[model samples]
Target: MATTDPLGIAEARSQLGTLVARAVHGHQPTTIRRSTTERAVLISEDDYEELLRARRELEAGHVAEAIAAHDRGERETVTYDDRAALYADLGLPTPGERS
Candidate 1:
């Protein structure tokens, strides 16, 4: 579905019935705006839950834990050659090679 333009609180409230109807049928989401500036959003219950779950995963430090696990056996040193190799691989002149 196409993206709907942002809506203010009053516009949303006035058309609340239609919005609910559209949402029930899985129509496109409506972006809620306020004071000519964007604010929170109104979305289907399922979508809201998914958003919350994603936020919780980020806040609970799950990402950091995963990174720590992945780097368990990796080396900690970073060298000048590493930077030079990366630059060469990307077809970019290395720091000292620049004219």
Candidate 2:
């Protein structure tokens, strides 16, 4: 989901007050760029905090669902006698082994 066009650093710097007002009062987020690279975003404090809270809630819900699934025996369990063989099968490094 892309927002409005990004503002260059120079333009943003010159219009900091206006940009802040737009983000806060107009509920519009502005992307700030350095040269051609996107650097940061300007959004209301309330909106930022709300986004953070929503992310945490979503993560917590995922964790709870995983726990419930485990409790219900909905997950598969694999036990490998040779840990190195298991890692090789999965194309991953065994414990204490460097990639």
Candidate 3:
């Protein structure tokens, strides 16, 4: 089946092996669409690890930039008295936010 076609969660359940094969061997990620707005992709572990590594690198770059900006007096410092205050400042309670 074409990966371009959406796979409903129920159908994905029965054909998991095929989906895994497509991802692991073909490097083709399959989207298991659950709803109009929600879905998950089945990708190879290698792909997932690469994505994670890329994200870490990006985050580190951002942090370095933030530090450089701070050193240049281009950033302001604010003190928060509590977790709620800090979270509020950062627009906390983000979707699916974890502790």
Against the unseen true structure, what C-alpha lDDT does each candidate score? 0.63, 0.75, 0.77
Candidate 2 lDDT tens digits, 1-99: 225678888899999999899889987888888867547889999998998787667656765775687689985555778978766745555656644
By summed lDDT, the worst window of 10 consecutive residues in model 2 runs over 90-99
Candidate 1 local lDDT, 37-85, one digit each (tens): 5576666787768866876565446435544755894434334468767
Worst 10 residues of 3 by lDDT: 90-99
TM-score, ranked from best to worst: 3, 2, 1
- What's the residue-level lDDT of 50 in candidate 2? 97
For every candidate, C-alpha RMSD to the true structure in Å: 12.4, 8.2, 3.9
Residue 68 accuracy (lDDT) in model 1: 70
Deviating ranges (above 4 Å) for candidate 1: 1-3, 58-99
For this target, which candidate reaches the highest TM-score against the unseen true structure?
Answer: 3
Which regions of candidate 2 are displaced past 4 Å?
1-3, 76-99
